[model samples]
Target chain A: MKVTLIAGSNREQASSTQLTRYMARLLEEQGFEAEVFSLYEHQLPLYGPGEAYGHEEVLKLSQAVKSAQAVVLTTPEYHSSISGVLKNALDFLNSEYFEGKPVLSASSAGGTVGVSSLGTLQGIVRNLHGLNCPEWISIGSDQRKFTDEGEPADQATELRIRKAVDTFVHLIHRMYG
Target chain B: MKVTLIAGSNREQASSTQLTRYMARLLEEQGFEAEVFSLYEHQLPLYGPGEAYGHEEVLKLSQAVKSAQAVVLTTPEYHSSISGVLKNALDFLNSEYFEGKPVLSASSAGGTVGVSSLGTLQGIVRNLHGLNCPEWISIGSDQRKFTDEGEPADQATELRIRKAVDTFVHLIHRMYG
Candidate 1:
């Protein structure tokens, strides 16, 4: 199955991006084709009505999401919710693109937990008609979760991520296998 | 007192912008200095961490909001909430710029009502430390609310907007008069 992992932060070297990469690796290890879609590479035009929606970047990102069998979304908390970059990217697409696809909601935060961001992502995914996994992965105190090489630093974080990814993979398989 | 009316849509001839301009006219009628800030004119870069914050447009917007005694925010409902263009523009600044400032939340929608968008905008303003007015203006079936000259079409919609603006102006006077 092809699963798309969206690193929802636009920041270079963001902890959220590191966590997304880790999830991608885990999916690959499980023998699934994982594509990491970095927000940095898809700098979308601000979505506004009557504005030209023919931007190549927006179309590329949309096509990727449309083609994926399932999706994994990772974001960093900003103002107690998902980052505006992620939300803005989502705004460019309609509910039809995400209809009935399983999505894994994951987040990393500077605080002890990223529950709020998880909830926000869940709400957004539901709004877009994507079925979000009940078991979400949130790496709190995120700065410590990743090492200098952009990999998960501790075994505990790795285990949590693996479990979450496994759950998502299983759900997708059950739904679309 | 100075009031900033933000036309939160990027469309060339959006009803949201028309309603924002209408509100600005009402404020002017009340002898308040009102400035209409159109998101189309701002054309802000997508906000992200570690991105250069020195963009002249961002700086100008920040200065305008910081200097205004009160702000009236208007948006078109996109996916049951504010437009991404408006939200991305907001991401360029921090809560400090809006601290203690009065804000009037307004919206125009294609449906029969825009209550959801009003609630969402209210929450966002509170998150940004802006004191939101309780009397919000939501123009539903928005296409019918405006004329060819980009003005409010009916006496009823005009009255509703005037009442909201009057309430906002009174609150600002009580706070900063």
Candidate 2:
């Protein structure tokens, strides 16, 4: 089965994207076909109600998510919530796209703790009608967590990320495999 | 004194923008120079931390908000919170831009009641160090609340908007005038 990893930031060299890459590798190691959908490549127009939903990028993104059996979402916390780029991408989709799919929420923040964005993402995922995995990954002071090559710099952080990924993968198998 | 009204959606003829226009007019009627800054006209790049803040549109938006003594922010509720476009615009700014400025929050939603986006906006404005005016305007069933010309269709809704604008203007004069 295919599991999509969405990197929720457009910034080049973002820690969130690094985490996404790491998660994708982990999922691949677990025998799943994993694809990383980076927002850096998509310059989606701002979503406007009543406007034509004809953006090629949005359509492509919608299709990718729809085809995935499960998704792992990673975002950089901005202003104590998920980044705008991630939220904007979600805005392009509706409950129909995510309904019944399992989503694993993850985030990275500059602070010592990364709890604030979890609630926001949970609320948004619920609104999208996606089943959020009970296990989540949050890396605080994220700038110090990753190396220049986008790999975890510390073993402890890497272990935490693997644990979260394992739990999400287990849930996916149990629920939909 | 200048009071900036930010229409927090990119949809052409959006009810959020209509409400913003209405609020701008009310502020003008209250003897304040009010300008409406519609997101429909801006195509800002997604914000990236640690990246060079060099976008011309972002610079222009920052300058506008900095020049204003007060601001009235209106957004459309999406996924039970403020639209991503609005949040993206805020991400481009920091506390310095909105510090000490009084902000009046408003929103429109498709549901029977519009309360979801209010808390989210309040938290963001406070994080930016802006004083959020206690009075807020929320127009629910927004599609039915406005006429073809974008004016409030009913006297009751118009009255509510005017009252909220009046309260906001009063607070602006009291706090920053």
True contacts kept of 1: 0.00
Off by over 4 Å in 1: A1-177, B142-144
Task: Report, for every candidate in turn, its global Cα lDDT versus the true structure.
Answer: 0.79, 0.80
DockQ of all models, two decimals each: 0.01, 0.01
Error of 1 at A76 (Å): 28
**What does the lDDT read for residue B39 in candidate 2?**
89
> What shift in Å separates residue A1 of candidate 2 from its native position after superposition?
0.6
Supply every candidate's count of residue pairs whose N, Cα or C atoms clash at under 3 angstroms. 0, 0
lDDT tens digits, residue span A123-172, model 2: 67756756556567888774346777667998888988888788678656
Kindly report which residue pairs in candidate 2 clash with one another.
none
**Docking level of model 1:** incorrect
**Candidate 2 lDDT:** 0.80
